[model samples]
Target: MARTRQPEVSNDVTRLITQIRAMIGKGEELPPERLLADQLKVKRHRLRLALETMRDAAELPRPIIRRNDSPVLKSDVVVQGTNALEVIELRIVLEPAIARLAAVRASPVQIAKILEAATTPQGVTRTIGDIAFHKLLADSSGNQLAASLYAFLRRVGSDHRLHVPTASAITSERIQQRDQEHRAIAEAIAARSPDAAEQAMRQHLRRVQREIADRLNPLETA
Candidate 1:
């Protein structure tokens, strides 16, 4: 009698499950299926099977399914009364900690994403790249709850156009300066220097706050 081997798809799913466990912290929610599959370079169906197996084994949390009759909360409803300055204030307090954690916890792939997001591409809005950089740090922190909270903050900032600066403020010199600051933060994380990463993030946010304050009241800065 010949030995029976497990199916190739089953082996792939098992391998993905192991990779995912290594990639994320315990209790961290996996990224969306499509994104996770893309990131792992595995087929979506295989990822789904892996997720299902994990869920059955109590390794992953149960999905949150909403009833059709439940009221869906709108973004505006959830993020009321917040302005740009307030958002920056919250980010100043929150992001340095995220940077520190990213220094210690970020996987190699996450560090690559953080580095890639550090500078704005030609013709893209600087604010968008900045948001992506910060959010990548948050996600790389290995804390899913922290990542979710930071995502909410970013959504609030974007929905209200709170972070976009006026054309007059978007000078080439300022852009270059911001790029340097972003790289400093990213490099600190890559080097696994938690204190340096935290300090760099704090300095960057403080600079942004100063810019926003100057914009809102030019006289005070002058």
Candidate 2:
């Protein structure tokens, strides 16, 4: 008997997820099926199949509510740039401590995973991949306190993306900077330098905070 090829279901799901992430990066509010079908250039049925696959993979959550109405512009929504600044500020207070704990608690496998995620080509996905990498780092840290804080930080990052216009301003250079900072923390952790990791992480976050503050309140220093 001839060998049969498996359906590329996983590839389809990954494609869908990438498209959705790209749309989110551009701050576009996409319609569900039509957007998927149009972007993926697949039939509605295939699009639905891809969506289901993604949902199963936990790349997307099942929709809680469906609407037949037209999209409404939310004028009351806060500007996204400001929201991103708030998220960065919150992380400045939270992630350094997580880094410290991760240094003390992470297993070798978990540490390797964290480093791999931070240094991977997929890390170019910017906000989405970066957030996922940080979540994995927190989980690897094996500290409940750090895990909870990481979850909170992830939520804040998500909310910031939704509300902040310039959130996708993450560039290759910026990603490189973030990757280096994360690598420094990870290396310190691997070396059992908890205090050094914490300090490096804190310093990186402080620089981020300062950059955000400069953009948000440029007149403050004058």
TM-score of each: 0.67, 0.56
lDDT string, candidate 1, 1-222, tens digits: 999874354777889889986553322346788888899998887888888876555444345454575545555765676688888899898999999999999877778767866877666666666765676788788777677678777777777545555538567898889989999999999999999999999999999888888888777767
The 0-to-1 C-alpha lDDT of every candidate, in the order given, reads 0.77, 0.65
Summed over model 1, clashes come to 0
Best by lDDT: 1
lDDT of 1 at 112: 77
Candidate 2, clashing residue pairs?
A: 80-163, 80-164, 80-165, 81-164, 81-165
lDDT (Cα, tens digit) per residue for candidate 2, span 59-104: 3435545365543423224333347666677787778778888788
Error of 1 at 33 (Å): 6.8
Q: List the RMSD of every prediction in angstroms.
A: 8.0, 8.7
Question: What C-alpha lDDT, on a 0 to 100 scale, does residue 175 get in candidate 1?
Answer: 82
